[model samples]
Target: MGAHGAPRGRAARPAGEDSRGAAPAGRDGYFDLLRAVALVRVVAYHTFGWAWAGLVFPSMGVMFGLAGTLMARSLRRPALTVIRGRLRRLLPPFWLWGFFVVTAMLLHGWMPDWRIVYWIVPLGDPPGSAWAGQAWEIVWYLRTYLWFVLLSPALLRLFRRAPLPVLALSLVPVAVLTSVPPPEGRFGGALTDLATFLFCWLLGFAHHDGVLGRLRPLAVVLPSLAALALGGWYALTHQARYGGTYDLDDNPLGQAFWSAGFVTLLMYAKEYAGAVGPVRSRLVTVFNARAVTVYLWHELALILAVPLTDRFWEVPAFERYLPLESQWFLFGVGWVLIAGFVLACGWVEDVAARRKPALLPGGRAARMGT
Candidate 1:
């Protein structure tokens, strides 16, 4: 699955539906909307480098929670089958994106070694040319997500045996890391990310198992609000330690608690149980379908946008008429390029999903062969 995109499968019926008269199994529009918003927030955060954006949405945690819910749903089948299906959906789009990135790095005089193989599986942070910039940072999310998927079978079993206790215990690793000096380098970074989001991931299991739904309204709301408060308080007071900002990304414990609280409430509500209306449904479908492509290519698009926008300054008419220097203009250009990549490369997701390829998903043309 993409960092911000969950694996898609038929969701379990919502809480109130009677099985006999239940509507057919279908997409959860609420979950789909969360993902679409996460992807958009990711692109916007990367483009604008906004600190408060993390507070506003906390995209990574939400994505992990959603992925965990879907992963639990899929584990109804054989474990090996579920894992294989996930890898199949995830890797092809990555390989296609890697082809261009790795080739670019090599052309820029990047020396290859055994570490280059990480690009193939990305079990670790993949090496890239410095010239490639922060584009490669997105791989951390993929690496973390892959770890979650692989461990989920065992995690789910343990979660089911004792839902509340295991869910509470999930916070231990992050708590320990936050108290002590974290380890240095790639392993530490990966461990921090895994630990940080582990709570949210298990919260997904809680949501799936009806644990949250079974709880009283106050039980769910009070602790969640308290968490949100503590996380906000910590971030506010501890800003100077983290580059003089309260960006959740800089504070693992804050992010973990905040995201856990925020995502839990969203998942619990199960709002918009049916389709999120017509036009929004189509947009959600496109976002979920091409999620991998959007995430992998978005940074590169933003990188390319800078030079492309710079070129516009040379044309007097464009420089005067356009907000050429504004980050908003760059954001717009980035999405335009993202749309181009989706048309050019997004079909790999369809192929991976065993659906007929389409330039854009959820359209009449894509519907033709299905």
Candidate 2:
């Protein structure tokens, strides 16, 4: 659903420790793996438009949770320093991506107004040509993320003061919003999204602070399952009201509770941090490194893949060999483009992090080591 910023310095403490009784000292692969999977699911859901995908893996909530955990870790330093660092890491990649998108929109006859500044800071939804609307719609995630980063210092303090009660109360906003008639404009939409995922974001805070670690397994599991069931039940019962689909994105109250329960279990099981093997670790690294590039360009890739796939039909040999009409083929082609974007644009992330740019993250180091 969105790209997550990685935390620098030490990882969060796991629920359990090894014989040495120390936490992992570098990037947390379990969190990385969750983020990578969430990114993939976002691409897949967009390409396939599957409603049940939200239930299976609430990608947006998962991403916000990962970002929240990392934000909490980074906030151990001065709040201003952490926030500036996050924005520095986040914005350049966005600006670079926006350059092309905005240029294309302008070429397509989009007349700009004062609101075009949203393309820079994205505190609100940025405008785009209707033809490329899908690409711009994803900016809402970044907008929400920016707001979270800016607000985390205060949110973290509140959570630390009363972790359980604050966590429980985080769901109230979405419930209240959903109980009323849905809001009508961009601000309303943003509010709904923020309230829907605020609990998961706080769950990340809870994870980083080791709040969930102190809970009894049953205490965590029972409530989480109950919430999950309630979310599913609400979606099922309210389908007709929400375009006759069970997609969690269509139901804020359902998404809030569903993602809360789902992400809570994930953060609660931090022991699996060590379960990731070497090959998977490298893959996770790349995903985390290029998350912004991949996320920003993925919709464009999917959109372009359609026309490209249609072109393949003109070549008899290509038509014979490729399943050009299948959605799977489009999915595969979309990833191929995503990989290309990662290779082309991912180095911006390295530069933003103040590291040397490489085709792949750590490519230079790996070569030097060899």
Give a tens-digit lDDT track for model 2, residues 181-227.
Answer: 56699889888888998999898888776676556567788999999
Clashes of each: 0, 0
Deviation of model 2 at 169, angstroms: 0.4
Q: After superposition, how far is residue 340 of candidate 2 from its true place, in Å?
A: 1.0
In terms of TM-score, how similar is model 1 to the real structure?
A: 0.90
lDDT of each: 0.82, 0.82
lDDT per residue as tens, model 1, 104-220: 888989987787888898889898878886788789999999999999999999998888899988878988998886789989999999999999999877766657645555677
